[model samples]
Target: MSVVLDISRLEPRQVLFAPSPLSELAEMLHVLSAPDHHPGLRAWATATATGLSSGLADRLAEADFLWHATRADILLPARPAATLAEELDALDERDDETFVASALEISCMAQYHRGVPQPLISAKDAQEARERAAIRGPRQAAFADRLLTDPRGVRAWLRRLFQDCEREFFADAWHDARTRLYADARHKTELLRRKGLAPALTAISPALQLDDQQQRLVIDKLVDGAGTTSDLGLTCIPTAFGRPHLVTMITPGWRPVIQYPITTPDLPRPMTVNLLQARLEALAHPVRMRMCRALARGSHTTGELAAAHGLTAPEASRHIARLKKAGLITTQRRGRYVGYQLDLNTVARLGSDFLDSLLR
Candidate 1:
């Protein structure tokens, strides 16, 4: 399925392009929590922030808590808050209720990123959201309560987060990565200036197809949200943290973001115990091993695998998701059926890496 955006009404200038520090910082948090999705990247980030203080590392790893506090909407700047500090400041300035409401929209992720955009909600909606969120767990509601009670705490947290990320690698890394990011921005602008919006988008990703009759840019993006108004246009951001996969996000009252992977694939593979441990730990399961064996037979659907293993579809799906995240399974789609196949090359590499890591 493709999300089709009507760019005919949107001016080329209205379609802004810039690097977002919030996007990068959020990505840093993502890789830490879900390293499987971002192969080789966590290794690079770990190396980049080698000199980080142990206390800071522990605090930074609390990305989920950070997400709960700032709300996903807080991170996507209304203007271009090019730095993390600026984004946090923008969030702190917003009414407490609106901020909490926007965050509740992103408290959970939908399938394949193909979920639809949540409509802008109100302060009363925020209160309702806090109550609903508390059903999942009280911590999120309590977190919002603290933020609402004392906004200064938000400012202080942002200062510390910005300091840690900047001192770690965001500054130098963004500087080093900016050349390619800027070049991409320039190229997309030129396409818009000459060939127009459709060409610029198609050039950005091969999966993009223009349907002039439909008045929308058809994209094979795995995102839930769809469409943005001409006033906000669409923000195109090239990000390092979201490497190897395109990401699309739409939060309440903010411009929609299409954060495509950076062109450069230069994630450094420094020898580290955690990298090896992550791979090894991924296989520490009987069900996953059984699923691996089932997959070895051939590319199969979750239902097919589940039936063969006498597993509930959800149970099989969970195992499959974990194995895939660990870089052991690759996916292929044929018509409506998506098949999962084992990645022998990665499994082989895992063995080699495990041996190599132990020696170090």
Candidate 2:
């Protein structure tokens, strides 16, 4: 199963590369909702989740559907907007029917993420929304009922939720990430011009491939669908928060957008000394050093690490967790037990990273 986008009619003029602040915010909200999927962002997401106001946390639970249907039309600007405020302003200017229709449409798609075999709504109407609301469980059902009964109010409520996310954390996060996002977009745009469309498109992610003969951009996905980029030209949005997955909005009536991951890992953040210290501390302990020596040879189960070190399972597990968090090791689950392996590259980089931190 895959998504095939016909690029036969796609023109260079139709292709756009820009950073979508609202889209990034939506993806960040998604990171908060499902931190496990984003291991690199787990720490920040956990802290952000802990610090959110009670009211905002409750709203996030209700709005959990947004993360799953992130490529929904309403969440994305019609054209590239320079700032988050600009995008939010454009969203505010939309008509009532557009808001209602988008909400209903996105709600139906959210059902699919919940593992529903078919969409809850066949027709995008108030009655269909009401019917879906009845089975959406308590939290989402309330959000759905509000959308059908008071669309305008729902719009305002959602805007506030988005605003709260920006004011609280995403503003700072976007500030830190925008430079990297913009650079990645520029690089991809240049790739399109210099290397041609196929290489440029596939460079966005490993899951994407271009079939030159078929004039199709084949995306490896679980769901199956095919569409042409005739009416809606392709817009490529590079997102820092959207790592490890690619999202597309090729559904009929939505502006086509591909929210792809940035090719490189996140730029090294500040607090270099603290980071180096944490890594050093992870290895400074005698038990951890021996564990690393053993793991350096090959992967070992938690039971093996414990037995070899003459320690209890809990003690070995604690050391393993600390080392894993410090980026010194990687873990793979094997049936009932978890296997741990030393991350040689990260360990080797520790010396250089420490030296660079001190001099630069």
Candidate 3:
């Protein structure tokens, strides 16, 4: 059978009337694959192909094909604002880590797919990252230096990189998709209240529902917003892109935390060791680890993370939740959205300690 036949003639309810970026990519791929097919699709695919490496284009083609056959669900809209607020209140009443874990999972996936670099910070990047660290306090400079010199230390420091990406991607896609679905601001808000992320309006919807804990977490974030502290202890505001906002917070000891005003859309800066530990623990699931490696560059939310990593949102969420529970990262709120960032300090320290033990 032809590859197109692989896609069912009866469109799945999940995809009916919904714009599928993946499908669009696939149609383009099919045209590219068959020279005799529609000339328009072929021309579009060829044009897009010019910007990508052959390997990446082939991977995207495979992804497009897989998406067509799969019945994966998408993120759901937020519940009614009142109910969401109540749910969040209930969540705060309980100290269980489940909701936090879920948030973390989303964050980890986001980071793996979208967060920024904490590599063996080049002398240039290192010097600047360290200078920022000094303003936070005295010990931070040494901490930054240790992270640069040690292999395990650097890896640990950079682990949250993935979570950051996950967070940003989720927010951007959700907002854009939701806005397209409901053009009116008041209606969009109302819809967000009903569904959780963005309300689904289509007759055939693939929107996933949020549990009570998830609902509560979203409520708390929506009302409070999220922000991070720079290495110098100055609060940095989150830019629209998210990851670039937290890039300034690369200090030691003093890591970023989720706070109101939602200044920066990136994750908190935890210890390098914490990040490393989370990554190592998360590595037990190779797929999650692969996702993490990808996010080291910037933030991506659940959907983008899944698309990039070639996994479903739920599957990716599971791995990300595990990373969050390990205290390797944190999440932030952007409008009715969430984003992730690395806990650089904790991860850096953990990495340095591990190296010390190994050398001993």
Clash count list over all predictions: 12, 0, 73
Off by over 4 Å in 1: 48-51, 61-71, 81-93, 108-128, 131-141, 264-360
- Record all residue pairs in model 2 with backbone atoms less than 3 Å apart, i.e. clashing: none
Order of quality (lDDT): 2, 1, 3
lDDT of 3 by residue, 1-360 (tens): 000001111111211112222212222333444534344335544664475556554434432321222111111111112222232343334322222222222212122222332333334444555565455454545544454455343333322322232242323443443343323334433544465342322111111122343321121110122222222222111112121111211112222221111112254432233344456777467776565555444565777777888888898788778867876556777777666655555455455654333233
CA shift at 244, candidate 1, in angstroms? Answer: 3.3
lDDT of 1 by residue, 1-360 (tens): 446565567777778777777766666666665676667676865675576778777666543554422236555554656566677677667764465445545663222243332323334444654565566566656655555555457547756876777777678776776677777777788888888766777666655667856367666644334565456788887766676556655543457677776564454232233444556676778776666666655799988998988999999888888787667789999899889987765665566563333233
TM-score for all models, in order of appearance: 0.62, 0.68, 0.22
Top candidate when judged by TM-score against the true structure: 2
* Candidate closer to the true structure by TM-score (higher is better), 1 or 3: 1
Which is better, 1 or 3, measured by lDDT?
1
Off by over 4 Å in 3: 1-279, 352-360
In angstroms, the error of model 3 at 336 is: 2.2
Best by lDDT: 2
Error of 3 at 193 (Å): 56
Which whole-number lDDT from 0 to 100 does residue 271 have in model 2?
Answer: 25
What lDDT is obtained when candidate 1 is compared to the true structure?
0.63
Compared with the true structure, all predictions reach lDDT values of: 0.63, 0.76, 0.35
TM-score of candidate 2 on Cα atoms, chains taken together: 0.68
